[model samples]
Target: MKKLFRKILKYGLYTLLALFISLNLFVILSGRFYLYKGIANTYLVGESGPTIYDLDVFAYSTLEKGQGEDLILAQNYNKQKLSAADRAFMESMETKAFLVFKGDSLIHEEYWDTHDKSTVSNSFSVAKTVVALLISIAVEEGKITSIDEPVATYIPEFKNGGREIITIRHLLSMSSGLDWEESGKNPLSDNAESYYGSDLYGLVTRQKLITQPGETFNYQSGNSQLLGFILEKATGKSVTKYAEEKLWKKIGASHDAYWSLDKEGGAEKAFCCMYATARDYARIGQLILNKGKHKGEQIFPMWFYHEMISPSALNTADGIKNSRYGLHIWTYMAKSGQVNYCRGIKGQYIITVPGEDLLIVRLGSEREANITLDPARKGDKNYIESVRNKVGHASCLFHYLRMARTLTK
Candidate 1:
C-alpha cells in the first residue's frame, strides 16, 4: 500500500510540472505575458481585478506643480449635511470620498474607510478626459494641425491597414473602430496587455481597423492610448510634463498627481490610471464652469471647449443617439439642466452642473454595471423610442445628481 501511494504522488507531481511548463511556453509564444502578471496581481492576491487603490503597484511619472497654491476653501466646507439614507448609501458603497463644490469653494466633503481629504486614489478612465484636454491644448498651440487630421500623420504605423482614414476626431468621439476587446475580464484581451504588458506602442499599432471610422460609437482604451502617443509626438514632450506645465499647475491643484506608465520612462497609460485627490479632481469642473479659464486666463480655446461639450451627431450601431459621450466628456440633460462629467471605471466622477455652477466629485470602489437609457428631460428633442439614448446615463449618476441638487438647494 505504501509503494502504491508513492507511485500516485510521483505521477501527480510530474503532471503538475508539465502543465506549468506548457502554460509558460504558451504565454511566451502568444505574447500574452500580461496573463501571468495579471494572475499574480489579481488572483494570487485574492482580488478579482485591479482596484483604484493600486497606485504603488506600478511605476509612474510625477506631474509636478508650479510655484503657486490656490487652495479650494469655503466657509461651508463640511457644513452641508447629508441625510441618513444618503450617508448609508455612500458608506455601503465603500466610497472613499464624496465632495460637492459650488463654484470655487467646497460646500460638502466626506470620506470613509480610512480615506481623508489628501488621499490620492487612481482616477481610472477619468484620465481619458485629461488626454482629450491635452490634445485640445496641442491644437491650440498649433503643435498639430487640427482634430480632423488623420492619425497616420502622427503615428506612421497607422498609415496602413485601413487605419489611414481614421482621424483624430474619430478617436476623440470613441469611434476609432479599432479591433480592441476592452474587456478586463479576458486575460488575453487587449485591455489586459494595455494594463499589464510593457510594449504599449506595439500592442496599439498592431491593432487592425475592424470597421470604417466615424460611423458608430465604440468605447476602447486603445483609442485614448493612441491619442497619448499622438499628443507626445505633436507637443514634443510627455503627456505628464505637458499637463503639468499647462493645466495641472494652472488649475491650482494642491496635491501632486501621478500618471502611471507601462514602465519607468515608458508611455503614459493615457486610457486611465491618473492618481489624484478628490479636491484636485474637482477643479476640472471649475475650469469648465469658467469656460476653460483658470485665474481668468483661457486654458483651452473657446472653439475646443465648445467641441468638448457639444453633442455629437453619432449614434450606436443599434441606431441609438450617443450624445452623452462627447469629445471624451460625458453629458446629461436633466431637470436640473445639463451636467458634464468625467467618469472612471471604479465609480470616480467629477460631475459639473455647468448652468448652476455646481460641481460634484465622488471617488469610490464600485460603479453601476447595468447603465441604461434614462427618461428624457425637458430639453430632449429626440426622446422617442427610435432615438432614445440607451447609453446616456448610469443609475448611480442619478443618485448623486439628486443628492447634489438636494444639498445645494
Candidate 2:
C-alpha cells in the first residue's frame, strides 16, 4: 500500500510539472509574450479584424471632437461621478478594451493592462452582427432578394430535412430551432466540441432541428455558420471579400479585419472568431446606428436596417423580458431609453443607441462569471442558469452619458 501510494504521488507531481512546462511553451510559441508588440504594429498597418482599436480611428475621423473626447484623453471622467472602485473594476477586468462615440466623435476609450488600442481581441459571437450587416448589404445590392426566401434558394443542399423550412430571418433571430448545445465547457456538447474540433462547420450543420423554424428562440451558433455558407453561395465570393467591397471599404475602416475560416476554408465562421481592434468594431456599431449609411452613401437599405434591429417575431415577453433580440443583435431597455447591441461570448460587445446617437464597443478575455453558470449539484438535473446576465454594450456608455446629461442640467 505504501509503495503504491508513493508511486501515485510521484506520477501526480510529474504530471503537474509537465503541464506547467507545456503551458509556458504554448504561451511562448503562440507569441503571447510578444502579443502587445505584434498587435500594435499589425493593427496600425490594418491587419487585425473587427476590434475597438479600428473603431476608435473610425469614430475620431468622422465625429466632431468635444468635451467627451477630452475625457477620453484624461483617462478619468471629469464631469461624470465615478467611484474609485468602479474605475478599478473596469481596469481589473481581464484584457478589457472599450470605446464610446457620439455621432462619430470619440468620448471615452480605455485599454486595460497588457491591452492596448491595437490588440485584435476576439469578437466571438459579435461577428454575427457583421454577418447580418453583410447579408443586409447583399440584399440591398440584389444579391439576395428577400428575408422571406427559403435558405434552400441559395444552398440547395438544405432543401431536404427541416432545413427547407428555415429562412434567413429564422437564422438571424436564432429561431431556426436547430438542436444545438452551446454550452462551452461540455466536451460532449456541440458548441464546445465545435470550438476545439477540427470540423466546426460540419459539426454545426449536422445538427437536426428540435423545434419548428420560428417557433422558439434558441440561441444557436450553427445558424450564423449557415448564413456564411449561404452568403458564399449567393455571392460566389468569400464573406470577407464581400464585406470589404460593400461595407468595410465603404465605411472607411482604418484597419483590415480577419475572419477565421473553417477547415475546408469554404466558409468563414460568421458566428465567431472575427478579430479586429476596438475602433473598427465601433465603426460597425456606428454603421448600424446610422441606418447602414456612411457619409452620403446608403450602404444597406434603410428598411433592412430597421428590420435588423426591430424585435423578432419568435421572442415572447417572458422568454426575453428585459431583452429582445433582432436579427443577430441584442436589444435592451436602458434607464435612459431603448438600446441594441451585438454581443459575443466572453463579454465582447458592440452597442448602438439610435435615440442618443451613441455607439460603444467592448472586447475582453473571458471573464470568470460572464460566460457560464456554476455546475449543478450532483444528480440535480435542473441545471443552474448562469448568473451573468447579458448586459448591453451601451449600458456603461449610457451611464456615463446620463451623468453628463445630469451635469449639464
Candidate 3:
C-alpha cells in the first residue's frame, strides 16, 4: 500500500514539472515573457524589483534634449506642505512623482519611492494622447490630408479585414470597432499580446473588424498602433523621429525620453510605453493649456487642439453621457465639464484644467482601487465601461482630480 502511494506522488510531481517546462517554453518562444518581466519590474516591490523607468527590455529610441530652456521650478509656492492625509493618500498609491503647475510656474513638486526629478518611468497609455498630438501635427504639415482620411490610404495592408472603412479620426477617438479582446489578465487577449508580442505592425494590421467604424466608442490600443503605422508611412519618418523633431525638441524637455520599440529598429508602440519624467510630461500638459503653443510658436494648430478637447458627436449619440473621452484625451466634466488630461495604468496622470490654468502630473507604480461607480451620474456607464477596457482602475483619476482641486485652490 505504501509503495502504491509513493508511486502516485512521483507521477504527480513529474507531471507538474513537465507542465512548468512546457509553459516556460511557450513563453520564451512566443515572446510572452515580456508580460512576466514587466510585471516583475513594475509591480513587484522590494530590493530586487527594478523600477519601471529603468527596465532594460526592448531597444529604445532616445529623444535628445534640444537647446530649450528648463521649466520654471518651485516647491510649496502657493499651498502649504501636503496635509498628512493627502501625503498618505499619494504615498499609499505608490506615487513616484507629483508636480503641479499654475499658469506657467511649477508650484509644487514631490517624489517618493526613491524617485526624483530626473527619474523617468513608463507613461503607458498616456502616450496615446501624445500620439494624437503627433497626428494633428502631421495633418497640419500636410503629411496627411485630413483626420477624416481613410487609414488604408497610408497602409494598404489595412485595405482588407473591413479596416478600410476606419478613418484617422476614428482611430484618434478610439472608435475603430476592431474585434479585439483587450484583457491584461488573459495572455491570449490582444492587449497582452500587443504588450508582449514582437511583431506590432503584423499583430495590429491583421486584426478583424468587429463592427463598423465611427459607430460607438470602444477604447482599444490597436487603434493607436495602426495610427502609428499610418503616421510613419505618411511622413516618411518613424514615429519617434517625428515626435523628437516636432514636439519634444520644441517643448524644451529637460531629460532625454525613450520610446520602446516592438523590436530592435522596429515600430514604436504608439499606444503605450513612452518613458519620460514627470516634469517633461507636465510640459505636455502645459502645451495643451497654452493652446498648443510653446514659446510663442504654434506647435499644433489651434483648430486641431479645439477638436482634441471637444466631445465627439458619435460618442454622445451612442448614449455615452459623459465628458470622459476626447481625441485620445480623457476628460472630466465637473464645473461645466472643463477638464482634459492623459491617464495611464498603475496611476500615471497629466491632468490640465484650462479654466484654472492649472496642470497636475502624477506618476506611480501601483494602482489604488477599482473605479467608484456613481449610479447618480449619467456618464458613469460609459466612463466605467471604458475603464473596464483598460489595464487598471479609474480610482486614481478621481483621487488625482480631488488632489488637483485642493492644490490649485
Candidate 4:
C-alpha cells in the first residue's frame, strides 16, 4: 500500500508540473504577455485618430454626470447571481477584461491587472461582421456591382484555385466552401501561429478551395480575409480607413477604434483583430439594432441592414451545416424568438434582439471548457464554451430588464 501511494503521488506531481510548463509555454508562444491591463476609456473621432483616456478619470468624471437614462451602474444589478458562473470561469481562464453594455448604457465592466478599456482586446472573427457592414455600404455606393457578382471579377488571385466560381455573397455568408480550419490555441494551426507572426493576409489568401463555392458552408477566416482584399481592391482604400470615414465617425462613436495590420501594413484584417471600448462597442450594436440608423441618418443602406439580419443564400440547406448563419452574423432561434449576433473568439459577442428593442455586448476571455467539458477535461478545455454560454445569458438579462420595465408600468 505504501509503495502504491508513493507512485500515485509522484505521478500526480509530474502531471501538475507538466501542465504548468505547458500553460507558460503557450502564453509565451502566443505573444499574449504584452496585452494591456485594465479597462480604459477612449474618444472616437469621425475621421481622426483615437484618443485614449485614463480609466480612473473617465469613471469618476462620468459618474459625476449623474447616471443618465442611458447609463446604468454596475453596483445596482445582482451580478453576484447573474454572473457568478461567468466570473468563476473568467478567473480560471486567461481573461484580461470583461464588459457588458445594455442598450446605450454600460451595465457591467471589469478588467484584469494587465488590461484596461484603453488596451485593445483582439476581436478575432468579429471583424468579419464589420467587414460585412463595409461590403453592404460599398454595394449601396455602387462601388462593387452586387453580391451576386463572382468574387474573381474583383480579385484575380482567386481565379486559379476553383475560387473563380465563388460569389461575394458566398464569402459574406461563410459559405465559400473553402478548405481551411481555425482551431484556436493550436500552434500548429494557421490562425494560432499567424496571431504572432507576420503576413497573415498572405497566409490566408494562398489557401485553395476544397468544395464548390456556394455548395457548402465552411467557417473559414480565410474567406473573410479574401473579402477584405476584394473590398480594398474595389474601393482603392484600406478597410480601416474606409470604416473610420463611413461608419465610426458617423455613428457618433465616443472612442477611437483600431484594426490590427498585416506585416506589409497593406491589408487590415477584416476577419479578426478589431479593438474598441465597451461603450463604443455597444454603440455599434445600437446602430445595428436601430437598423443602421443613428440620430436620424441612414448610415448604412436599409437594404444592407435587411440582408444583415435576414438569412442569406449560404444559410440554406445546401450551405454549411449550421443553418443559422447570416451575412457574417449568427442567427440564434430560441424559445423566445430569433436573435442575431456577431460573435468573436474568446467569448466576445454582440447580440441583437430586434423585436425586443435590445442589444447586449459581452466581452471576456475564452470559457469553452467551463461549460462543455467533463470533470477531467475541464481545466484543459480553455473555458471558451463557458464564456459563450455567458454571452447568451447576458442577452437574457436584457429580456429581464424589459420585463422589469413593463412590470413597473
Candidate 5:
C-alpha cells in the first residue's frame, strides 16, 4: 500500500514540473513574453518604460542642427506664484512637469519628483500627433501625392484586404475601419500587440476590416501604425528619419529625443513611445500656432496645418456630440476661442491656445480621473455622475484647461 501511494505522488510531481517547463518554453519561443514584460514593467511593476530627455537612450538616427536658437524664457514673468491650493492640486495629479508660454516666451516652468528640464518620459499617444505632423511634411515635400489618395497606393499589400478604401486622411483622422479590439486588459488585443510586439507591419496588416472607411470616428492605435507603414513606404525612409530631417531639425529642439521601436533596428512603434522634454513638446505647440513655419522656413504646408486642427464634416455627420477630435489633434472650445492640443494617456498635454497666444505643457506619471478627485460638489454633480459611468476623460481635460486659464489671467 505504501509503495502504491509513493508511485501516485511521484507521478503527480512529475506532471506539475512538465507543465511549468512547457509554459516557460512557450513564453520564450512565441515571444508573447514581450507583451507581459511590457505590461509588468509599465503597469504592474511601476517602472516607466524608457527615458531620452537629455540624451539619446535608444537606437536612433540624429536630427541635424538647424541655425535656430533655443526658446527663451521670460525674465520678469511670475515663475513661482502658484497658490498653495493650486500647488496641492497639481501635486495630487502626480505631475512631473508643468510649463506655460505666453507668446514666444516661457512664463512658468516647474517639475516634481526628480524630473527636471532634462527628464524625458513617454508621450504615450501624443506621438500620434507627431506622426500626423510628419505626414503633412511628407505631403508638402511631394513624397505623398495627396491625403485623399488611398493608403493602398503606398502599401500595395493592403489593396486586396478591403483596406484599399482606407486613405491617408482616414488614418490621420482615426476613421480607419480596422478590426482592433483596443482593450488595455486584453493582451491579445491589437493595442497590446502593437505596443509590445516586434513585427509592427505584420500585426497591423493582418487586421480585417470592420466598417466602411471614413464613415465614423473610431480611435485605434493600429491606424497610426498603418499610417507609419505608409509614411515609410511613401518617403522610402522610416518615420523617425523623415521627422528628423523635416521637423525636429528645424524646430530648434533643446535636446535629443527618442522614439521606441519594436526591436533593435526595427520599425518605430509609431502609435506611442516618443520620449522628449516638456520644453521641446512646447516647441511643437508653438510650431502649430505659427502655422507650421518655424524659424522663417516652411516645415509643413499651412493648409495642411489648418486641416489638422479644424473639426471635420464627417465628425459632425456622425453626430459625435461634445467631441473635440480633429485630424489626430484634440480641440477645446474656450470662450476666448478654440484651443488645439495633443494629449496622451496619463496626463501629457501640449496645448496650443492661439486665441490667447499661449502654449501649456504638462507631463505626469499617474493621472487622476474626475471620479477620484474631491467629493462631488453641487455644481459638479452631473460631471461626477458622468465620470462614475466611465463616460470619458472630460474632467481631467477640464482640470488642465482650468489650470491653463490661470496663466492667461
Candidate 6:
C-alpha cells in the first residue's frame, strides 16, 4: 500500500511536468511568445492583464524637445468639477487623468492613483492620428506626393500581390482590405503579432488583400503600422525624429514623448504605444481644435486637417455608412457638438469639440467591459443611444461628452 501511494504521487508529478512542457512547446511552436510575456507581466505580477504603465517592456525612441514654447493652454485648476456621479464613473473606470479645456483655458483637471499632470501612459491607437498627422506633414512638404499613391510605390515588395493596389487613402480610412482581424486576447491574432512580434515590416507587407481596397471600413492596426513604414520610407527619417521636427516643435509640447519599438533600432510600433503626459496630449487636441494652428503659427495645412476630420463614406457589414472614423481620426455626435478625437485601446482619448472650442483628454486603463477592449467581448447591441441621428459609435464615449457638459457651469 505504501509503495502504491508513492507510485501514484510520482506519476502525478510527472504528468503535471509533462503537461507544462507541452504547453511551453505549443506556445513556442505557434509564434505566440507574447503569451509567455503576458503571463509574466500580468498574472505573475498580480495584474488582470497589461495596463497603461507597461511601457518599460520595450526600448523606445524619444521625441526630443526642440523649441516647443509652453503650451498655449492656460492652466486653471479647480475652476470647475464634474458631478459626483460622473466623477464616480471616471474613478471606477480607473482614470489616471481627466482634463478639460474650454477654449484656451483648462477648466478642470484631476488625477487618480498617483498619476499626475506629468504621468506618461500608453496612447495605444491614439497614435494612429499622430501617424495621419505625420503623413499630411510629409505630403505638405512633398515628401509623400499623394495620398492616392500606391503603397507599393514606397515598399517595393508589395508590388506583386493584390496589396499593390492598396493606397495611402485606403489605409487612412481603415479600408485597406487587408486580411487582418484585430484581437488582443487571441495570442495568435494579427494585433498580437504587430504588438509583440519583432518583425513589423514582414508582418505588415505580407498581408493578403481579402477585400477590395476602399470598399469597406474594417479597422486594423496593421494599416497604421504599415503607414508608419511608408512614412519612414518617404520622409527618410524615423517616425519619432520626424514628429519631433514637425509636431512637437511646432505645438510647443511640454513633455518628451516616447515611441516604443519592436527592437533596438527597429520600427516604431506606430499603431500604438506613444507615451506622454495628458497635458501634452491636450496640446495636440488644441492643434486639431484650432485647425492646424498652434497659437497663431500654422502647424499643419488647414485643408489637410479638414480632410483628416472628414469621415470616410465606407459601408459597414450591415451596409450602414461608417460615421465613426475619419482619416485615422474618430468622430461621434455629442449633444453639444461633433466630437472628433484620437483614441487608444485602453480608454485613452484626446477629444476635440470643434463647435464649442472644448478640448478634453481622458487617459486610463479600462474603458468598460461592455465596450469590448478584447473584441471577443463585443455585445449584440450594435448602436449606442444618442440625442441626434444615431452614429453607431462607441456607447461608452457618450458618458465622457455628457460629463464634459455637466462640469461646473
Q: Which candidate is the best by lDDT?
A: 1
Question: Where does candidate 1 clash, by residue pair?
Answer: none
- Residue-level lDDT of model 2, residues 1-409, one tens digit each, is 9999999999999999998798668657863443333335445577532333333221111111111111123333333443576566555544377676667776666677777765666678888988888888788778888877798898676787778898999998889887887764443466544443445556666777677888766778888888887788788888778877777777766666666554444456677777776877877887888888877789877988888777676643233332457888887654567778887766687877788877777777543342223334323434422222343233343443443344223
For candidate 1, write residues 1-409 as lDDT tens digits. Answer: 9999999999999999999999999998987887887789898999999888888878899997666466567876676688999888888777899888778777788888888878889999999998998899899899989999999999999999999999999999999988988885777888888998888999899999988889888888999999999999999999999999989998888888999899888999999999998878888767877778988799988788888887677767534667677898887755548778899887899998878888899999888764544444424555554335325466788889889878777
For every model shown, what is its TM-score relative to the native structure?
A: 0.91, 0.73, 0.87, 0.68, 0.83, 0.91
Better of 5 and 6 by lDDT: 6
Ranking by TM-score: 1, 6, 3, 5, 2, 4
**Residue 363 CA error for candidate 3 (Å)?**
0.3
Return the candidate ranking by lDDT, descending: 1, 6, 3, 5, 2, 4
lDDT of each residue in 302-332, candidate 4, tens digit only: 8878777765554333212343567888776
Clashes of 6: 0
* 10 residues in a row with least lDDT, candidate 2: 58-67
Q: What is the Cα-based lDDT of residue 236 in candidate 4? A: 87
Q: Which residues of candidate 6, in runs, are more than 4 Å off?
A: 1-12, 71-76, 334-336, 369-392
Candidate 4 achieves a global lDDT of 0.63
Higher-ranked by lDDT: 1 or 4: 1
Per residue, candidate 5 scores C-alpha lDDT tens digits across 1-409 of 9999999999999999998798678777986776565555455655554222312433434444456457787884655467787789889878889888888888888889889988777888888999998988888888899999898898877898788888989888877878877764476677767776678888888888888887777778888888888899999998888888888878988777778787778998788778788888888888988888877888888898888887654543223342456788976655558888887767788888887888889898556552243343535766544443222344666666677668657
Tens digits of per-residue lDDT for model 6, 1-409 = 9999999999999999999899899898986776776667777889765578878988789997666565444555576667788878888888889888788787788899899987889999999999999999899899998999999999888898788899999999999999987886775788877777778898887888888999898889999998999999999999999999999877878779999998889999999999998888988898899998976888878888888888888886644567777899987754557779998878899988889888889999877532222234334344322222234455657788777766625
Predictions: Cα RMSD each: 3.6, 9.3, 4.4, 10.9, 5.5, 3.7
* Candidate 2 overall lDDT versus native: 0.66
C-alpha positional error of residue 29 in candidate 6 after TM-score superposition, expressed in Å:
2.7
Lowest lDDT 10-residue stretch of candidate 5? 49-58
